[model samples]
Target: MAYKFEVYTDKAGEFRFRFRASNGEEMFGSQGYKQKASAMSAIESIKAHAPGATIEDQTK
Candidate 1:
C-alpha cells in the first residue's frame, strides 16, 4: 500500500494512531484515546471521509 495507518500505545499508555506515507514518513499523528476502539474508529472515520474532503486554505 502507498499509505497506511498505524495504531500504537503512547508512553502514557494511551492508544494513538499515525498516518504514514509511502516513504514511511508520518503525515499526521492523532490525539491519544483512552480506548483502542476509539482510535480504530477514528481511522475508519478518516478512511470514510477523507476521499471527499475539501481543502480550506486559511492562508489565502
Candidate 2:
C-alpha cells in the first residue's frame, strides 16, 4: 500500500499511531493513548472523516 497507518508503543509505554507515505516518511502522528484500542479507534475515526475533510487556512 502507498499509504498506511502504523500503531506502536512509545518509549514511555504509551500507545500511539503514525501515518506514513509510500516512501516511509511520516506524514503525521497521533497523541499518545493509554490503550491500544483507543489508538485504533483514532485511526478509524480518521478513515471515516478524512475523506470528506476540508482545508481551512487560518494563516490569512
Candidate 3:
C-alpha cells in the first residue's frame, strides 16, 4: 500500500498534509502550503519523482 497524507497542525495551526510510510508507522514529509492548489502541486511534483509513493495535497 502507498502512503497517504494526513492533516496536522503546524506551529501556526495551519492545516497541511503529511506523508506516512508504506508501513504506516513512520513519518515522511510534512508540507504546509499557502493554498491547497500549491499543496496539490507539491503532491504532483512528488508523484513525478515517485509514481507509487503515497502522496496527498490540500484541496481547499
lDDT accuracy of residue 33 in candidate 1: 100
Model 2 TM-score is 0.94
Worst 10 residues of 2 by lDDT: 1-10
Tens-digit per-residue lDDT, 1-60, candidate 2: 599999999999999999999999999999999999999999999999999999999999
Candidate 2 vs candidate 3, TM-score winner: 2
Provide the clash count, candidate 2: 0
Task: List residue ranges in candidate 1 displaced over 4 A.
Answer: none
- What's the candidate order when arranged by decreasing lDDT? 1, 2, 3
- Regarding lDDT, does 2 or 3 come out ahead? 2
lDDT of 1 at 51: 95
Scored against the true structure, residue 4 in model 1 reaches a CA lDDT of 96
- What C-alpha lDDT does candidate 1 achieve relative to the native structure? 0.97
Query: What do the candidate models score in CA lDDT, each in turn?
Result: 0.97, 0.96, 0.69
- TM-score to native of every candidate shown: 0.94, 0.94, 0.53
